[model samples]
Target chain A: MSDQTYVTSDPRGSITQLATPSRLEYFFTAGTSLSKNLRGYQRGQFIGQRCPVCSKVYVPSRGSCPVDGVALTEEVELKNTGTVTTFCVVNVPFAGQSIKIPYIAGQILLDGANLSFMGLIQECELEEVRMGMRVEAVWVDKEDLVPSLASVKYFRPTGEPDAAYETYQEYL
Target chain B: MSESPEIFTSPHVLEFPYSRSTGPVIGSFLTALRDGVLIGIKGTGGKVIFPPTEYDPDTAEETSGIVNVGPGAVVTSWGWVNQPLKQHPLQHPFAWALIQPDGADTAMLHVVDAGSESAMATGMRVTAIFRPADERIGAMADLIAFVPEEAK
Candidate 1:
């Protein structure tokens, strides 16, 4: 890359800054869609869609089915509980991370859902948590409620036996 | 007027659309914030964090617990932006700080009211300057910006 630089604020200053686009916008005129029918899970409800061709279930549904590549319809609710497939410890800090260092971010497969989602693990020591561990959802206070994914706070172990690897192998 | 020699250069442009999927859980939290509320997700350990996160950054499990964090926050770490960039919130010199509101375990990045580097400190206090109700948008800017608390 060329390292050409230009002055940002001061016209007479010798320091030069990189020239780049200041703003950007997108227009999806070609018709975009969601993979599954989304629902407000914090309100104690489940949501997803079923593909007409393969009859597969998808939560937070997409616009089209990955199997047959056809539009999916028929919304369905899923259970909030699920299993942890894999995870990582965020020991290193980065920009925009609000929480303290040495936190854990993991992927969870909600009950009755085919896909896994990422979330935080809390309420127990990092060492106490394990793979294939059973966890449950914790909702935010009602006063601070929103329609986004931050609704569920973090997952805590239920002290139940780790799920059998065969049960969630496909999720991995 | 006499013609001047012109410099020729290729204008390189970079752009990308971030398709953020606000899953059902976080989607509701953002929706609530848009309606004028500060929310946090309660981790299984009972610690609360602002800017409600989808999963516990520590365990990688799904989070369903929620909590109301604050109408105010504390300055945790800070830096002076004497030289402003185009994307920065303010065109004038300002301080960028991490504010941890009461009851929340994490800190949020924001601008502070210290006019000069000397006025701002790591432990100083500040509060949210909510945007006018009519101008509210579903983003951090919706909080407008944070300013230093007036000397009592």
Candidate 2:
């Protein structure tokens, strides 16, 4: 890969620079902030926080209530079933995307939880996965499970009727 | 809350693409490495900087001149990596060392491909091992790995 043939400018002393392509990596400490939510996965529990002011619950809570701006202290257990508040059919290839193309993924508002969390909608046709579709968590083998959302492989159709739009209208 | 998970972790891959002109000083040193030569620049106080920098790290002034130094040098300090990682330069037991090239006051960080931990030591003489010319493309990677002068 010499530049012998590709001479640029007059050859007295033309100083050209070189490009060094490289990568940098770092690890983020989950710390105490997101510890409780992660631990819940180990026991197959959907742990969340309840806002004392608004009574809204956040699944896998981040430190505070979004609307109230107050620290959340009350823990709540959310049901496995939830409504798909929104969704998209992914058909594009991307880095770190492990799922096959044309799969359904969306934000599911778990039962009794106010915040919507994202997960893949599986065990149904792509067209069958719609907004407000009822879905339940599909757990991976318990023996191989860890304290992470990955423990729930994906969300699958619950074979239940879609809730009336009015039930999730506030979320829209 | 009273119920808290002990620890949480997720895999995240980060990539950084640094695109810039090395200008004259750095460009020269790297070009020298491609030509099977090692170079440094004369910085303030008669000290030489290996893998030459555009400016003196301490004084932040433009460096003075280029000096040809060490194809040979002594290891000043090192850490042994017993369990080799895939991303590491060597896939075997090796030492990550800071070797001060002859005639240079400061040390440069690199790997030494000594067969065992017992084979490495401070003040051990080592030299740059450049990749074959046709295989080199003017990069720090061109200098494959340092080995004990005896091994060379």
Candidate 3:
């Protein structure tokens, strides 16, 4: 876009400001643990890794457990189902926001994964979103799957009974 | 896990995507660049800073005013990029240099298209080459690159 320039009048003096259009392009490599998780996504699976020390699984692991500081050695295939442990409704509009306003940006604790990851929660009324709400991954068409988390378009309410608060309270 | 996952690599762009107020000193400097001219602000001890900041780097004193500096410059220091990256200004190899333009006391960062690594050297005279007038905008990229000043 053409840069927009403006003259601002203030009590002190008028200042000239320009809207500087900028872009930074670079390559991003999904290293080890994330690579595994994304590879699973391409095959219609949710893969997590288990921390040997704490036995806790990390989805989209950072190649190691954050708390235990040890390599996550065991590979665990998790269900697409998950729980909305926490969320906030984005009602305010700002620059560079891709999703529409009033949508839920939730922390989803995938089944069998000890930790949660942020994902867009959709396909339900905004007021219906809540902690302990059961949700499921809504993936793109099977053939459209790729080695990226974007393969799953968003998470949606699963119509199952809400996971008990105690079941995911530790995650919050 | 028995089998290691294949490493996945993809291009990612982290962007600020917002307009920032350049204020007085920087605003004038960028405006000069868009006009195909170079300017510097007078600092403490009468030193001129190209790509001027609101405050003098050395004394932290407010700069006085803008002065026309250079279409000519000197390479104070430089490093060669043997293989240029995609984001680099020049698609091919070039020397990233700290160049002090003529009439400016402080050095500004820019690239020198000296054609080959052997041709680049500290204290080498160079000249700023601005992009076509129509392509000019109030940004650093307005000056496409510096080239070796023709031997006098």
Candidate 4:
């Protein structure tokens, strides 16, 4: 494809610049741990793996613990409910972004999982998204389920009292 | 608990998702390629550098002056692809070569359509074959591939 070029006047000579566009596509395998996690999502379950050395459970584990550098061999079933450990309001937009502008992207610490994962927080005003806010996964219809994170729509406030900071401080 | 299933595989697009600015020096070189001309920049030690850069690779001094170079080049080394990937420039078997244009001190990487691996060799001369004028868009893809000079 052709690049977009711009010529601007300058003291010495006209300056020339171009925006080069490129793309690539390939197959990505969701190895052992993640394959189980995604398949669990299809069944409306949240499956995580526990590292034997550290005992930290990771949702969508990439087969091993990042800190311990050992295989995560134990599978733990976790609840969709979690606490918003930290979050940011996304006001800027970019290409291929699916959520509307001004949405909340949050780090969620799921119940029974030792680590947190990012998820979209919705069904509340931007100012209402807090570090300890309780949230839960809102899944798509069962018939529409897929073996991917997309099976869960956005997470929303569970209306429960905010989780105490002491409960999720380690995640932050 | 049931045994874990086989690992899942899905199509993925590893995209750069961004465009980069080709500054003045590279902009000029690509612009010329779009115009059906191959060019080089004068570098340190009186060497011509193809696919010109802003600075000489050896001395790091800013490059100066432009000169028309090959349509003609010589293959310095090459690797043969028995089966091409989806992203490969050519669909059939081809050789990825380190080619030095007639007067260039540095070699540029490009593909050679030598028809068969048997036809490829070190020191073989090749010439650039450009895409049609209208199809060019100020990029390296403007030069489609090189072919053996004897067959040109």
Which candidate's DockQ is highest?
4
Alpha-carbon deviation at A91 in model 2, angstroms: 1.2
Better of 1 and 3 by lDDT: 3
Q: Is candidate 1 or candidate 2 better by DockQ?
A: 2
TM-score of the first chain of model 4: 0.86
Which of candidates 2 and 4 is the stronger one according to TM-score? 4
Model 4 DockQ vs. reference: 0.35
Per residue, candidate 3 scores C-alpha lDDT tens digits across B1-152 of 12334777777777775788887777776677777788887888888788777788888887776678888999999999999988799999999999999999889889999889999999999999998877876777888999999932
The alpha-carbon deviation from the true structure for residue B27 of candidate 2, after best TM-score superposition, in angstroms, is 11
Kindly list the per-residue Cα lDDT of model 2 for residues A107-127, writing each as its tens digit.
888989887888988889988
**1 versus 4: better TM-score goes to:** 4
For residue B115, give model 1's deviation from the true position in Å.
36
Residue B85's lDDT within candidate 3 is 86
Best by TM-score: 4
Tens-digit lDDT string for candidate 2 (B1-152): 12324655555657655567767776776677777677788778868888788778999877777777888989999999999988888888999999888888888999898889999999999998999977866678888888999998
Candidate ordering by lDDT (highest first): 4, 3, 2, 1
Interface root mean square deviation for model 1, in Å? 21.0
lDDT of 3 by residue, A116-160 (tens): 999999999999999999999999999998877788899999899
Tell me how far candidate 1 lies from the true structure as C-alpha RMSD in angstroms. 25.0
The per-prediction i-RMS, to one decimal, reads: 21.0, 7.3, 8.0, 7.0
Q: Candidates sorted by TM-score, descending order?
A: 4, 3, 2, 1
- Please give fnat for model 4: 0.51
lDDT for model 2, please.
Answer: 0.80
Estimated TM-score per prediction? 0.45, 0.58, 0.74, 0.79
